[model samples]
Target: MDVSGTRATDENTRPPAVIKATARQLLVKVGAGGLSPEAVAGDSGLAVAEVEAVFPHRDDLLTALVIDAYNESAAAMERADEAARAAGASAGGRLLAVTRALRKWSFDNSGEFTLIYGSPVPGYHAPQETVPPASRTPAVLAGIVRSALENGELTPPRRAVPGPPLLRPEAVELFGGLPPAPFSDVIERGIVLWSSLIGLLVFQVFSRTHDSVRDESAYFDFAVAVAAEGIGLVVPLDDGAHTT
Candidate 1:
């Protein structure tokens, strides 16, 4: 999975495995700002021209790092979701698990997280190549919502209590160019829940709490519960039984 989803195997498109592996190691140490083809080559004991052939510019190297970060984080979320499913967790539980996985990923790879989600580097406009890789995590969240919808556990928004309004373009793109069925009307709420999940991580990762929040874990659980409900996920009962 070279992020392009093409026929380019590890033997062809990118540099050698050691080069990329060593580059990531250096990325962790130096952060995105300090990253350079020459620097990576110097540390990896490989020729700079060899690295340049694979990554001609600084932005190319940055793009690779960004793709790697997104893939890793998305994999964490998907793996956690699978684990939750294996343990007989409901859709809501799976949502919580994936949310927890994302937060944990941010903490574990703080530098990488900041590299993509933090302040944009000047003049570094991500090319179209970044879109699919960037969509991976959101696709996982959408899957949780879709599962709940398919199981009839998600409640549709009522006319009177309409959950915000999504503009035409975004709604259409929310689900593979087709607005979410069954829960189509609540796409705006879904958008809020999705963005808010990331916002919560930004706050926690940047220590925006100023040390006031005694238990971030509890707070995260609370937020996940809210997001679950926001997307209309039915909660299981006290006896660990689903009422859906």
Candidate 2:
């Protein structure tokens, strides 16, 4: 009846579930400073060989966890976006939605978020050698810029700056009334804005500052206002730019 073949097939199919559950357990232990494969295997009542059969290596587990966390966060962000849009939110409103969503994700999934965002996982380098565009904070700023461009918030196109060395046609179209500067300038500003948002979130999540002065929603509003100002969007008065 080829029972051996049937057993092998079943084991192969079941290993993935065992591996995922084992990884989840290990992630929980990671915060307690006990996140070794051996520890996880011992805790899960699985042999080291069985654990490795699923995860292959420690980094593989971490990478899988990171990817899983990212997918969860992204899903939450999409739902937040939908909710904001349904409530007739403007770009500023969407910015708040995404910011709050990210903050909540970090707070709720501290271990997973810390592993991915706070420190690099061993042996598992990002394959692209670049951050995911959607995950990049600059991409969020760029989104605001794009929205502003579409809404006719930026001044009309006219050559204002001094030099004209090289430029992308898309860049030219977006930075209205701005000179033919390098695209790097725009990219740099976006990166700066992105960094600001991330830095604020990290600070708030980690509780680096005193609780009396910490208001995540207010900080988020300020960040959005600053980003909007950088991209020439009409700054909303109620965005908490002047608040702490």
lDDT of each: 0.72, 0.57
Worst 10 residues of 1 by lDDT: 1-10
For model 1, residues 1-244, the per-residue Cα lDDT tens digits are 2322222245654455545666567657876777788888888777889877767887877777787788889999999999999999888888878888898898888877888788886778878778777888888887877677777768766542345444567444655454355566555666678898888888888898649777777777777677667767754433332211
Candidate 1 C-alpha RMSD relative to the actual structure: 5.4
What overall lDDT, based on C-alpha atoms, would model 1 receive against the true structure?
0.72
Cα deviation at 141, candidate 2, in Å, is 5.0
Clashes by residue pair, model 2: 157-177
Q: Model 2, poorest ten-residue lDDT window?
A: 1-10
- Give candidate 2 misplaced runs (Cα > 4 Å): 1-34, 122-124, 129-141, 154-186, 211-216, 234-244
Candidate 2 vs. truth: CA RMSD?
7.8
